[model samples]
Structures are given as structure tokens and as C-alpha cells.
Target: MASGTEIPAETVAGRKGALSTVISIDAMGGDRGPAAVVAGLVLSAAELPDARFILHGDQAVLSPLLARAPTLAGRVDLRHAERVVTMEDKPSQVMRHGQGTSMFSTIDAVKNGEAPVAVSCGNTGALMAVAMLRLRKLPGVNRPAIACYWPSRNPSGLNVMLDVGADIKAEAADLLQFAAMGTSYARNSLGLARPRVGLLNVGTEEHKGRAELHQAYAQMSAAASAGEFDFVGFVEGSDIPSDRVDVIVTDGFTGNVALKTGEGTAKLISGFLREALGSTLLARLGALLAMGALKRLQARADPRRANGGVFLGLNGTVIKSHGSADATGIAAAVRLAHQLARADLANRIAARVASTGLAGQDAAATGAEAGTAE
Candidate 1:
């Protein structure tokens, strides 16, 4: 039996009855531990007036934390798990012996229909492994991808990019599926009716990029109509944050590198701006005059505002929050998860893939064979 006090059956009945949208959370997964997770829940509760949470972690550790957070008294359902998956734990080991861990318990809640979404700041690999094992992949999804929001110049102020570290490699068909999934995400999350998707390449020219990208380009182009998205052929790295495309599709290797590089560049630029502003009295005076604009810029460019990465192609929606996320970052992730859940994100992606026929078994098999041959 789980040790923590379970929210009453009547209180936790349906997603819409007592709670708005319940999100299962791995309280023990983050670097800041359960305290930060509980704090995040308090923050999220204020932001999402209708949101509820199922927090899974060690009872002894979490009980005290919850007692300290009186605001979350009836809003959270606590599930006790004795073990935790450390950052050092390998995905393979977790998959083999993950039954009693908090991460597994968190995913299992979504798997069992207790919640529509699962959020974790745990080991990405282990979390993905447990999710795939418990929730399994959505039908017609060959290789699941991790899609994240990128601060962009678009009207919506964000662009969706996928495979941001779920798997290092993506075949042509996989990339095609990523496009469909990303388009679904953009449509649902950003309220875009027909999202423009661009395959990531060295250049925008159709002739550029390797064989797989070319193949993906052709496949996405053909399926654009059925997928209800506009395929913009190829998009270069510079176009990622541009308003030209709503979704950027690429393999995990390139996407992860780009994601990290962009984050590092943002930090570097912010540091440079701070140093330059403080270097001279004149610059400091100028900064003080533009303080409001600078604050707006800071808020607009804050990575914490776009923290969660949605694990696409899963049977249940799973959000991977950054492991080092603090209370604000965790709350941001939880908010994103709740937004996606309210939008019925999982069903939208599945329906898009199924209707497009891009996820057919033959296409996946062919792409897998081609990837191996390469």
C-alpha cells in the first residue's frame, strides 16, 4: 500500500469534475529534490486555478514538505514510492529494475488513466525508458521524439522543435513523423490552424543536406496536405527562431546540439550585456533609462519560461522538465503540461499521424533499413 494519504476517491474522481486537469509528477526526480517540487506545485496551483497534481515520491520526505505547503492540501494526491532513479542510473538498469521507483510510479499514473499527463525532472534517459516501457508508444509511432518550445519571433512567440534528445538518430520516416507530430503540437498548443513545418538542413535549398533529410523532405512534402500542414522544404539553423516556420523537424543528435548551443549563446549574450552595461557609468545610466525595456527583454528571453520538453509519440503525454529546474522552472513545466493536457495534445498527435499514413509499418521498416545501411 502507498504510505501517503491518498486524496479521497470522490475528490479525485474525474479530470473535469473535482479537478481541472490532473498531472502526475515525479517529486523525487529533480536536482532540487521534493521541496522544490512541492514549492512548484504551490506556484502552479496559483497559476492554474483548475489544475490538480498527483505527486509520487518517498512518503517520509514528501509528507513534511506537503505539511509545509498548506495551499496544496486538497489539490494534490500523494503516492508513496520507496526508491528513486538517480541521475547516474543508466536507462538499461532502470528499465530492468524500475518497478518501485518514483519515476515509474509517476508514469504509471498516466498509463492507468489517473492523469492525462506526466511531468518529471528526472534522468531523461531513465524517464523515457520507463515511459516507453509502461505507457508504450502510440500506435504507428516508430521512434518517439522530444518536442520543446523555442522562443521565436513568431506571432505566438514560440516554435516547436522535436527530437531534442529523445534518440540520437532519426530515419527519413521518423523525421516525417516528427513533422506530423510537431505540426500537431503547434496546432494544438499555439492554436495554429495550418502550421508550417521545415526539415532541418544545412541550407534551405532542397538539394542540400544528407540523403535522409532529402528523403524526409520529399515525404513531408507529399504528406503535407493529408497532415494538414505546410511543408516549407528545408530550413537552416538560422531559421529555427525565425517566424518563417512554426515547427522545425530534425533528428535528436542535431536538435540537441542546436538546443544546447542556443541556450549557451543566450546566456553568453546576457552575460556580455550585463558586463558591458556595468563597465561604465554612462552605460549604467543608459541601462537604468531602459530598465523597463531590458526587463521585458529578459522576461521574453527567459529559458525558464519555456522549460518542459514534451515526449511525442507516446501513448500518454509525458513532459521532461530540466533536471536542474528550480521552483519557477518546475512550475513553468507543470503549466505547459497542463496546457497540453487541456488541449488534448496526445490524441491530436495520434490522430494526425494515423490520418497522414506517414507512420505506416512499411515506411518505418524501410526507413530503419535505410538508416542502418547508412
Candidate 2:
């Protein structure tokens, strides 16, 4: 219903409370479908006493899982939608004729105010397309970006990265907006007075890539000078986890690769250590003594903290977990959404967009009003 057809407002509505908002989940959207989603829901209920869920999917397919995970069924309500959009479903098809699908309905719940956020693990492209089409943008936002949280080496806090496969090709202005948007997120959610923002570039130089880098460099520098954020210049992939920067901005394609590579490396390292320790008696004894340390490291290495991606720059809060997310992973995403909604992330972003003159008009508009203070 949100369209660029209308002019951007000078001010957007304030954020609602997390406890005041409900989470709508598509139980049949992931690799394991309702079973895994149900397990996650049950865990979520225990962790979040105030936040509830509205499961949108085929009740017939979910009934058995519902019985198995009685706690979730008892706590959360259900809304049936006879159809589901699978991982393999064509995005174009979903974009073309997926009106009655459960994923759409789940999102519709948020649009209708029945839920504050929507979480799903199915058809990334379809979800992004649908959300963009339905929720629209926050005035100045060109294309909605996806953000994922990375657990820093320092456990005290986490780092955030955005455009993780949302927009493969990004404009310089878009990246700058993304950085500003990201900074606002860190400040609002992590309680930072001035969040450090970094552009994902090959090097820390002012001029890096061919045209794209040069263009983005100018915009980012200007935003920083304008006091939009504590812009920390360019950061390489290696710098993402060093905790040197609070927000790392990149295009979706590169961000997605980096995300997947990080996960793959973690798994590889864990497996390698397991095999190496089992190969010798001394190593086995060492492993026994260091089991707790190993487990802790493994947990730290996990990308799940960064696994659940947030669709930033949208009108409403929508968190998207990995398409192959497990029960615990999904639970974590729900919890993060709870925190974000409670943190008033949407309202904060809206305010930033309004104050900084970001959300001036939906790009789709041919003649949206312009030239305002915010």
C-alpha cells in the first residue's frame, strides 16, 4: 500500500513499543519449514514473555508441529494461508502472481498493524521484492537495504553491516544514505552517542574504485563533514570484525559473499580443530581440558548474531533470518526484532530521514514535493 506516489512528509510517526508490537512469522518459509520454525517459536516464548507471535501458514501442515511444540501453540496464535513460497520458487513468479501466498500475508499483518515486525526464511528475493513493494521506502531511501549484526571479537558489543544482497549494484548516494541509516541504527539500538560509520572499500584511500568508489567517497566525506555521523573512512573486509568500525557499508553482492564466507570459515575451523585433536592422544587430552574454551570459541565464531538480517530504510521493522536458519537461529532473530522494535528503530530512522532531508519523496513519484527543511 505504501507507494512513491505520495509526497514525503516532513515528519514521520514516532516508533511504537516492542512489547506493544507483535511478531508475525511464516512457519513454512524455511528449509525445515514448520517444524524448525515451531521449535524456534517455543524458545522465543520462554525468552520473551511480553512479545507474542502470529504464525501465518497452512494450519493443516503445522498442526502436528503445533501439538509437538505445545508451549508455542499455547502462547501464540495462528492464521492459516493455504499456500507457501518455497526456497526454489521463482522470484519473478512470486513477484508476478504470489498474492495469496502465506509470506505475503505474514507481511500484510505488519502493514495492517496486527504485527510490528515480520520474520521469515523463505525466498529472499521474493520477500525483499514484496516488502519493498508493500512497505515502500522512508521518503529519500532509494532501495531498502538489509542489515546483519556481526558478533565482534570483543563480546561487549556487535558490529553491523548492510546491503547484504539487497542491492547488488549500489549508487554512491545510496551508500551514503545507507551509512547514515546504519549510524542511526547503532546509536539507537546500541546506545551510542556517535556511531562510527565505515565505507566498505578496497583501501582506506579517498579514491579507491574506478567510478563507484570515487563517487561514494565524495558523498561519504560530505556526510561526515556535515556531522551526519562519525564517519571512519573506508574499511576492508578484514576490518569488519576488528571492532574498529561500528557500521560497515557495502553493496548487497559483496556483503552477502562476505557473510557466507565468514560462516563457512567458522564451520571449517571448528571441523578442522575437531579432526586435529582426534588425531593424537596429546591433542585429545588437550581437547578434553580445553573443551569449554573450544565451545566458547565456536559460539563466538558463529555468524548468527550477524545471521539475522534487518531490512533497513523501510517504513516498518522487518527482520529476515537466514533462509536455512535453524530453531535457535530463528529464535535469535525474533529476539533481535523484539529489541529493535522496542528500541524504536523505525521511528528513529524516520526521524533521521526527516531531519536530514532523506525521506523527501518516494523515487517512484514523478512530481513529489521537494525543497524542504527536512
Each prediction's number of clashing residue pairs? 0, 4
Model 2 ranges with Cα > 4 A deviation? 1-19, 154-157, 225-228, 357-374
lDDT string for model 1 (182-213, tens) is: 87777666767678999999988778889999
Per-residue lDDT of model 2, residues 237-354, tens digit only: 8988877788898888889899888778878977898899999999999999999998777677676655578888877778888888888889888887766655556656776666
Pick out the ten consecutive residues of candidate 1 with the lowest summed lDDT.
Answer: 365-374
In candidate 1, residue 227 scores what lDDT?
Answer: 73
What's model 1's TM-score?
0.90
What TM-score would you give candidate 2 relative to the actual structure? 0.86
* TM-score against truth, every candidate: 0.90, 0.86
